[model samples]
Target: MKQIINTKFAKNIFLSALALFSTVTIMAQEEDTSSKFSLSGSIDAYYRTTFKDGGDATTATPTSFANQTGFALGMANLIGTYEMGKTGVVVDLVFGPRGTEATFNNDILNGVINQAYAYWNVSDKTTLTVGRFNTWVGYEVIAPAANFNYSVSYLFSNGPFSHLGAKADFALSDDVSLMLAITNPWDTNDISASGTYAVGGQLGVYGQFLNAYYDGGGQGGLGFEIDYTGGFDISEDFFFGINAAYNSNSETDSGFYGAAIYPQFTTSESFAIGLRGEYFAATQDGFDDVPVTALTLTGSFTKENLILKPEIRLDSFGSDNEPFLNSNGEATNSLSSFALAAIYSF
Candidate 1:
């Protein structure tokens, strides 16, 4: 019996050694065929102040982020990507005041993580991704380096930010694509306390996308939203972009609708100008609608990896509401502000 036990133990050890050898060999082969890992990110800062009769920074800006008075820190973004064979992973981290606000719904354990996801290319036409990712419904993203404007629009500010879910993307043809996702309720990053999930779909064709998201009713739930985002290039240096969205909550019978247009012209390789004109409104059950119009003009100047943007914005509200305080500390119907932002990307 002792000899038999000794022989069995030897066999087990040999099998383990063989398994380790096989794993190492496979890993080496994969490394040889994989693409190089990449690291990239950006840092940003800005100074903002209201003009004329507009109040301080906190009251003058009704939207989100970059609202602090005077000089302020934006955020530090760092993204690392690794691809091996048909699988890839992206780990994006953000730090600073802007990052804190953007990840307000994130899990306490992973506070600074903006996005962490893994994707698999199942075939030439299909890919599957899982984990936390930025929302696909809006025209603007959370990263400052990616947006042409320094401040966010009302439509992008009010919409969902990021989602934790699993998604499948399919390339229908050269010009058409489709994506479907199942996720926790809007902005519910870690887990759903209400034990509910949301569904999202996107249809893309010729640089245009139609997006839809629906969540049954739960904490931080966005009942349903239908959005259209697209852009067109009229000339070598001229471009036009548009975004329209409608959101509703069947449980409360309240919602909002808005539309915005973006027209940009490039004057030189290092300088460009753009404008954002938006009309937004909000409604509630048994209440009159509140309407507002905002116009923003921004100029972009670039030198190497650094970008500087000088922007001016005006927000006007319908006579029904006075949400701003003027220079004399009196309620007013409009507000105006100016902002200068600097961003460095690599």
Candidate 2:
């Protein structure tokens, strides 16, 4: 019967994601038992083998990797954190199934708290937070030591992940920094969230640009961001600079985004390497007969906790378009896909 109501709606969204991790830390009353809580996440399981150059196998897009072969790929998170003193609470959830968790696979469970916010230090350049945050406008990172561009880019994970509501952080010194948010934009986590395409309110700014001396490392920081999304039927605005990006919409009357400045020279450390080259295109999404073009090249290998990634990609939108899978499953429509990744982190 519709798979028993989709397994009771995935067990009631996993018990409302465990009641949003204990309803505001037990309705806030305070207890500090030596202040300590630590749990972290990262693991994008890999093992893919597919080479479907077939003419037509059910005409692709069953989440297409074409003619779909075996040795699948899934699992993109591992998290948890809790700290005492200055108050702390975090519940990072990600369960992407491929091997276990009652098979029918894709072990879904991401964010009841991908990031749970709570911070306060009311002085020396203020700080405050409410719940669910993270959006510096993207160099590249959903959170993985602020990525240098490693499989998750197409305007930084399709632009927007975690921007719940209520935020404040300003440290206009020691290299200037200021953040402001009054969000609702993303998935909003049920509570009767309505008026959909997404735009309940969002605002942000992060500055760092001054002192220039080349060779990829020497006072290198320049960024600009702008976003005013309110799309339930279309009303979106976007901008980002330090590379380039621009957007406008009711389904794209414009689209220009950029990334192709390979860098990975972080100092005071052991070893690091980040190289990237990317391009994404769309102009006239109001539909002049649909068009989309994509290309990517990525690499990252860090020493510390260990991280390794390698990728290459390409895509085309029409002519019955089929090809685009690079998180190591390797597939490209115009032609290309090869990936190798390994991550061991704490």
Candidate 3:
């Protein structure tokens, strides 16, 4: 009986060793594959206080114009990526303080698809991406959650936001890259139906002068890009681009907006400074005959996880639409105000 029990115990030990070996082999195989495929992303959250003369539905309070404050609380965003060989898949999801505003809302939807794309290399110099994606336009961008420049450009979000279609990237050299995209112009994140469908494309070139890595850790770099996007029924108004950008509708019966932005500066490894100055116009000739041209200046400072931005924006809604909030949280007409905010990202 003792000999029989020893045999059984040996058999169990052998089986356990075999199982462990198989598990280790499988894990090693997975690791080998992952060495070829990489995945990464980030998340941003913040708390804020607001002071105002009670303006806009974006904030609903009138505590004190000089010291009105409330919670600017919300989780900014999250993103994920999967890469294999020359192909990659990336998805970005954003959640904002507003919860989720509308299906029409583009980047900040609670669980919506901000970017779900499959990208592949067509050649050493060219690559292609398909599925819902962002246009290769705009100075400020919606770069996942890992980017420090979190606040968006008015033209970034409010301009022509997103695209659902195809885009190609070509490397001109070590210093330059060009992109072209053709997209469904029903605008973005749109669920409603409109009779006419708009189709559009963008051409962009991105570049930088020089760079350095800090074993000591600091931050400063120089870069710029030009993008043009406009394909419809319009003249004297092609989305011409300089650090430049432009937009014009396809018809005269409807009004459109256009701008040329040449924003650039310098940054230290630990912090930096930059500016965005742009000119804009909106005209819808019949019931409203107004056009506006304005400029905005913004400055920011950053140290590790803390970021503070003091900005002054000037806009002329061409006598048609501006910023205003009534007692019942409603808008009356065109009015404008000034505001400042500080943000921290971790």
- How many pairs collide in each candidate, listed in order? 0, 6, 6
TM-score of each: 0.88, 0.30, 0.58
- Candidate 1 lDDT by residue in tens digits, 231-276: 9999999999999999987767778899999999999999999999
Q: Write the per-residue lDDT of candidate 2 for residues 152-180, one digit (tens) a residue.
A: 54555444444544455667666555555
lDDT, residue 19, model 1 = 58
TM-score of 3: 0.58
> Which sections of candidate 3 miss by over 4 Å?
1-69, 97-111, 143-154, 175-178, 188-246, 260-269, 286-290, 293-295, 318-346
Best by lDDT: 1
Q: In model 2, which range of ten residues has the least summed lDDT?
A: 212-221
lDDT of 1: 0.84
Q: Write the per-residue lDDT of candidate 3 for residues 1-346, one digit (tens) a residue.
A: 0011133343354346445544554554555554244344333343233223453334422111111233343345445776654556787655553223312444334446667776765469977676676545554445323222333433444344455555667777775766655333434443212212223334333432111100110010101123443222223322222333333332333333345443434345544443444444434443334444444454556667655554444444444554445445565333233334454544
Pairs of residues at least 3 apart in sequence or in different chains that clash in candidate 3: 51-68, 218-269, 219-268, 219-269, 219-270, 233-250
Taken over the whole model, the C-alpha lDDT of each candidate is 0.84, 0.42, 0.41
**Model 3 lDDT-worst window of ten:** 213-222
Instruction: Score candidate 1 by TM-score against the native.
Output: 0.88
Q: What local lDDT does model 3 show for residue 39?
A: 41
Winner by TM-score: 1
